[model samples]
Target: MSEETPVLSLPLIQPSQAQKHVTHNEALMRLDALVQAVVLTRDSISPPSDPDAGECHIVPSAATGVWSGQDHALAYFDGTAWQFLAARPGWRVYVLSDLQTVFWDGSAWTGETASFQNLNGVGIGTNSDSTNRLAVSSEASLLSHDGAGHQLKINKSAAADTASLLFQTGWSGRAEMGTAGDDAFAIKVSADGAAWHTALSFDPGTGLATGDAVQTSATDTSAGRLMRADFGYGPGNVLGAVSESAGVPTGAVIERASTVNGDYIRFADGTQICQFNASLSYISAGLCSAVWTFPAGFVSGSTPQVQGTLNSDSLAASAPSVTVAGLTGMTISGLGATSVTLNVNALASASFGSGESVDLGVLAIGRWY
Candidate 1:
């Protein structure tokens, strides 16, 4: 048998030897230093001069006085002098100064949490709650990266389920920015923690955003809102029929009517332009007139501007090369909201065109309201 223990190396009492009680007492003194050890400190370089009995310390490197040469060993005062036991791997002690348990992990003393895996419901500086699972009460917390980068992600179970980060003041919710109440990302705010306002939200597919604080219609002049584009347009929107009372656009940007008699084009700014065609006979010599009724009337009280040009059918080398277009004067008369009369003065010479196909293209501009 060995003279000392194989584990703790406690001195064994010699067989049939005198002073066996001294060896047994030495072993008991080593036991008193270990076994649920509570160390004063692990930074002591020397033994204390007035240490109490059974007081233990971890002797550091290059220990001075009575602890000289006993580096990294557990030292305890045994009433007369100090006793030491060499430290080993897996040796544990509760440090009074740090108020934590440390263990010698074959290389150095490390905190009990130096290596841990798969621990859940672990609270730091607070208690973990049922729903929270891992609650923390602190002024601030840090989650640093191991080498290059870090990402904090919150996932949800379904599209309708909420996955969000809520900010609170005095246990009352104040603001939040995350995918809340749905898969879309949203930012919501609350003044009294009871009523909430969705300040912004984004679509998952199109990445478009919509909110009450955003300017929707193109003509919206409200302040304190972000300018935004409408999600839908065309005939259902700015291209639709004119409706001044509609809150979207004041009226259609542009509207057109293709009629057999009169073709008209209307603009949003209340301007309407219409066209008409006329074929007059030159058999009536001096002043011939034709009245054209507009396909659409202008806003009453507004007289439309009328102008026309004659595209003569037969220009068989007429006299007076200066008036080659057959007619001397074309003027507008009796202008009104819905119709106007075009007067033409035929040439005095008998160079009358035989056909009534004296086509005249006329245009009128006025307000359509």
Candidate 2:
């Protein structure tokens, strides 16, 4: 047996690509006479578990061919058969149960999906819609919660490079400042910390021209303060400074005065704006932000009075009770007898008859018509 070394013979290893099993002698003799005259189709094609007959839920060598129950369930895998692996490699886990649809690689679980009923439940923000549901957090700013709290915040980072959005009606709170033309704004307003009301301001007079906004409507809220400030400047001429926080009231002031009701302030082409002063009560920078509206039948006196006399003689009834400050509501026409009209509490005395009372003091009033 020492010289029998010539019995060494090895040559049998094929399969580069030879998989051609074509058997159809009339479809395998009509499937072997219909599987031997069928007994429930030969026990339903037998093999449900039979790793070479050792059986034990066999179907794992990865999965050995020809065992179709519509093609494997539970552990999935059903592409129309042909799978065999008998285990031994990464704990085999094939799941293809009609893999409805899938796809996602932002991190993990990506069989590429779009169906499978939207394969939910598994990782990375799961799936969100409303603008990505606030996207992401960790102090990069912008946060919100509606389950009842978290309020609201949006400050990716800003202390004063420009930050604002305050709107509260009745209790007072309004700040509006946003410009991109001519550019110049400095407005202020506040309450508790002890008065601050630098209300309306806008400056951008020159060529780049586009800056004009000043709005305030504080129709008495008893005492609780009001606020509204705006400031923006960047068009070259740059000269903007109007600062006051609380109820607002610091230095340079003249925030509002544009009386228009039969408007008046005439100097035509010279820059002193305001017009329509019928009886003239406008004493420039003197006092009287706005007042002058009398044309009805003014004969109602007392804190809300209006009396008119002196129909002609160039107008001069000369102060009697002298209280008629501005006529906006009471309209008094020429009273009978011989000229007797007086409206104070806002003073209104037009004259002509002087009917000889001589006291230049009027007190004969009584006309409801």
Candidate 1 stretches greater than 4 Å from native: 46-53, 62-68, 114-116, 141-149, 168-176, 189-199, 215-227, 230-267, 272-303, 306-365
lDDT of 1 by residue, 1-369 (tens): 789998889998877979988999998888877888999988878677799999998877788998899877888888888888888899999999889999888767887985457556778888887687778889998999999999998888887788888999999999988886677889899998999988889998999888767777777667787865442235555664554444344646777886766788877768889997775444354545678888888989998888887665433332122244456657877888988877766666534443333457888999887
Which one is best on TM-score? 1
Q: How much is 306 displaced in model 2, in angstroms?
A: 35
lDDT against the true structure, per candidate, is 0.76, 0.29
Which stretches of model 2 miss by more than 4 angstroms? 1-148, 156-158, 165-369
Alpha-carbon RMSD to native, per candidate: 7.0, 21.8
Model 1 root mean square deviation, Cα atoms: 7.0
* Global Cα lDDT for candidate 1: 0.76
lDDT of each residue in 1-369, candidate 2, tens digit only: 231122211122234524323222223332332221211111123344422211112222233335543222112122233222222212212233422222223222223324545543323334545544422324444457778678543342432343334434564764433221213444544554235344444555732222122323322333333322332223321322222344342212221123433222211111112222233222222221223342221224412222333222322343232223332322334443222232222323422122211111112222211
